[model samples]
Target: MVRKHERLATAWAAGVAGVVFALLMAAVIVLVRVALPGGADGGDVTTDSGQRSAVRTALALLPFAGIAFLWFMGALREQAGEGEDRFVSTVFLGSGLIFVATLFAAAAAAGSVLGESPQSSDFGRRLTYTLLTTYAMRMAAVFIITTSTIGRRLGVLPRPLVVLGYLSGLALLVMGANVPWSELIFPVWALVLSLNILWGRRPASARPAAPA
Candidate 1:
């Protein structure tokens, strides 16, 4: 009973961490979006204090978010245990790692814009855009798909959530880089998944019939 209680506590802790990861990452995206100008012209890059502050805050949050994500993954794996489908689990873990890597790459690309001359800001801005909206989102889509697939196979997720994951994954894969702010969906999905798990929506065991 004690071991089971500990496991449950760990699961809840992991769920909270996952939610934190989503929140921090979402905040970073929003802050960076607000700080950057709409026009792609490198000449428009401004090092104003507000934008700089936003970028700095975003940079500071990213490492914590990544660490939380790693913890979330480990906790989720513990929940799945040895019964999980090996192939799907492998893909899920791999895509998650790639997602974090590309996410950091995007942040670094954006950070590089800070020190550059206004003339060079355009190049950095475009690079950051491509890295984040294009590459990072693609990896996120793969992660979502694999996670949804695992959840479906394990019966650990509700049908509506699984369908929502597919839709979100499709948006990331198909409309990615083209749709502004589309990357928010990744964090939003993570929030939903974490909340659902934390709500004690575990797989049920078949109960034997009551005695007559």
Candidate 2:
């Protein structure tokens, strides 16, 4: 009974955290994209007060998003228990940490634009874009791919969802830097995965055995 309750709690934690992280991240991405539709080289974002406010809001929400993501990741890992592969788990953990670090770095870079001259603002904006689209999204892709692989190996995710994960990961890997708003894919994937957890769709083998 204790173990069953523990598993239920962990699942709920994973599902709730994932949903929170996804919603926060999606909002941040939308706010940032709307505020900076022209990308780094298109326009001077510092001149517009509205854009600056939007960017500030996005930056403010980023830390909370990162925190929720960490919780989601930890809870998902806990669900894997002793069956998790050491090598894949290492990649999963590394990618997640790197994604958060890069995300923070990008937010910092974006924040610097508010206090800088037009000349330096351009540099900061470019740096922010590079960190977010190129580095952070790449790490996100790796995390998604590794997670899907782990889920498949553990029989925790269905085949359709696994295929979707692979496709989403690949899209982010190849087109994330070039495509505007592509970062939303990560949050969408998280939302889907979280919903699956909440629905309790796992195979019987993946569940804890009853206390005899």
Candidate 3:
């Protein structure tokens, strides 16, 4: 009984962490976009109190969000367990790491635009957008696709979610850069996955035992 309860508690904790991962990512996106309305080339890189504070808050949330995302990724892999295919797992891991690296790179570049030296704002803006929209989102697409494939093969993810993942992956791959805010699909997908993980779980005692 104690073991069962412990497992339940652990699962709940993981689920909550996954949701937190999604929420934090969304928050960073929202806050940053809101703060940088003029964008990189907009020539409005003002260091006003309101914009600076919002940007600072977003930057502050990023490291923790990245950590939570890593935790979430590991948790998903753990749930997939020994049955996960090697090739797909490798791609999944690689893409996830790339996504994190590029995400941070973009954030850093964007932050530099708001620094005291506004001369490099244009450069920073270009680099940030290119890194985020062009590379990071493609990696995110790969991550989503590979994860969906793994879940499909393992019979873990639902059919509809698998379909959505594939569609979103395609969108990210083909149009992520062209479409504004398309990167958001990644976090949104994570949110759905986390909710599924939370809601689909059943207690061991609640699961029906197989008859001899």
- Highest TM-score against the true fold, candidate: 2
What TM-score against the true fold does each predicted structure earn?
0.88, 0.93, 0.87
RMSD of each: 4.4, 4.6, 3.9
Per-residue lDDT tens digits for candidate 2, residues 37-125, read: 87877588778999899999999999999999999999999998889999999999999999999999999999877865887678878
Q: What lDDT does model 2 reach?
A: 0.92
The C-alpha stretches of model 2 lying farther than 4 A from their native spots are 201-212
Candidate ranking (TM-score, best to worst) = 2, 1, 3
Worst lDDT run of 10 residues, candidate 2, spans: 112-121
Q: Give me the candidate number with maximum lDDT.
A: 2
Which 10-residue span in candidate 3 carries the lowest summed lDDT? 38-47
lDDT of 1 by residue, 1-212 (tens): 99787778777977898899999989988987877756244245455778777778888898888888888887887887777898888988998888888778877877766775775566767877787788888988988888888889889889999999999999999987667788899999999999987876343444444579
Residue pairs in collision within model 1: 42-122
